[model samples]
Target: MQFTIAEIWEHTGLFARMIIFALGAMSIASLVVMAERMLVYRKSRSESRDFAARMGAILAKDDLDAAANTRPDKNVGHLGRVINSGLTAYRVSSSSKDVAVESVARALERQAQREVQSLKRGLGVLATVGSTAPFVGLLGTTMGIVNAFNLMAAAGSGGLGTISSGIAEALITTAFGLLVAIPAVMAYNFLQGWVDARSVDISESSNEFLDMVARHFGGSHS
Candidate 1:
């Protein structure tokens, strides 16, 4: 019997329907996380580049105050935050050059950790959903096969139509699962690359800041 879309929906088994619903929810969650993370990474990358340029010039002038003041107000980009943290520690230990270096080093390390964690926010969800979605789809497919067999057994003389309808309905869940998972996986990979690049930028900025601080204090302490 040929079935219209509405009839197909009406005949969809409860298990298949539930699996489809779950896949839809996962798709929504992945999309939300992907959008949020993209914005955050973009902001961090843009602001950090600007902050680095400004701070480089400030340090060139031997102006520590100017470097500290280079902290951007719009968004505390990774570079600004790391520099601020190290500078704060350096100022607190200004009495001794060695102590100041040690303090800044520790502060930068802690701040870097926090920055990495921030960059990774929402990534776990994307990864989890991506990795599990295909399996979830497979499970739905298996359930559909089971359902098809059961329907066939119940309708011994009904020919192929009895099992074919159930099989067809079940396959839809597998397709839906793949649709949800593919984009999620792609987004996760793209975002992960951005996070890694940003992390490198933050690390380089930290090292640059430390070197500047050492040079500025080395003259006085010598």
Candidate 2:
């Protein structure tokens, strides 16, 4: 089947609406993922910095309580929540210091994992959209092309204009799909890295806090 540029443009116009809709959905998802990840990373960085400063002061004064209380919420991100859990356990485990340390540490680890998962939320959806959107657009494009060819055959047109519209529609959808997928994939990867790094930072900071607590308490609750 032959296609003229003008004919292609007309055929693609029909699928343009659907492609626009898909692009809109993909854009919203990507923006949400980007915004949420940025917020989480920013908060985590601030908390980590504040906590580090507080930890420095506590170390300088050798004050366990001060260290424990120092910007407890501000010092840590979601990881702070996990550390707090361990700290709480440590305090309660005064009766069995040995067992308490182990149990509290384990509990904190679990909580940390949960927090990491929370930080990573919505990433999967973004990734899915990115990975599949192109193919979906391709499908639309293929359909448009097929329809154009069929129409050309039916019309027995000598001019390329007969199938140009359908072909154009097909290309447009494919292009739209790619445009949506690229950013989504990039955002998903960037956020995933940020979340992983933040999680590691939280884990390390929590470990330091736990160690300080253990050392001050003579490795076990009295």
Candidate 3:
């Protein structure tokens, strides 16, 4: 059951390859998540800024349509879409006494929530991968250790050299798994924060827009 470092390397050849492949996959996934989240945050931030400026102009001039169309799709995030929905509803309901502005506002709020959820899509997958990768690595390590022990028992030797290869392979896989997990977890948290912050900004701006509309329509309570 005696093993040398060279034997360990030889025995772990395929396992090393598997670990490398797993690490690569994890890296790619993390990168994709980071890029997608960055794009979403950037678009939302830009849209919110433009919307704020346009809204300011609309408030001063009392031009609802102009404000509604100000940024269009580029500046329109989930919040923008919701605000547009409420504005459209309010305009259409203007002639009907039964249809209230509050009703339109509520509808838009619901739509906004849906958009938020959509934006948050794929986050769960990233979190799961991040949280579980280390455990998976540990599992690999445990298996490797078991195999090393089995080899030692088969060899009927107490020589550490005999099992060193298997142990090394196990350690290598575990390290690889952690390497994958660390970045995934970090990216998930960072993106979550970014999304939350942008969402807050979007909500605040939308609220302001809603209040402006309410005042224009002579609705009580902003």
Which candidate leads in TM-score?
Answer: 1
TM-scores for candidates 1 onward, in order: 0.91, 0.82, 0.81
Off by over 4 Å in 2: 1-16, 59-62, 69-71, 74-76, 158-161, 217-222
| Clash pairs detected, candidate 1 | none
Candidate 1: worst-modelled 10 consecutive residues by lDDT: 67-76
Which is the leading candidate under lDDT? 1
lDDT value, residue 66 of candidate 3: 69
Ranking by lDDT: 1, 2, 3
Clashes of each: 0, 9, 5
In model 2, which range of ten residues has the least summed lDDT? Answer: 66-75
lDDT of 2 at 117: 89
Tens-place lDDT digits, model 1, residues 14-99: 88788888888999999999989888878887887776676667777878766565545656687778888987777677767777
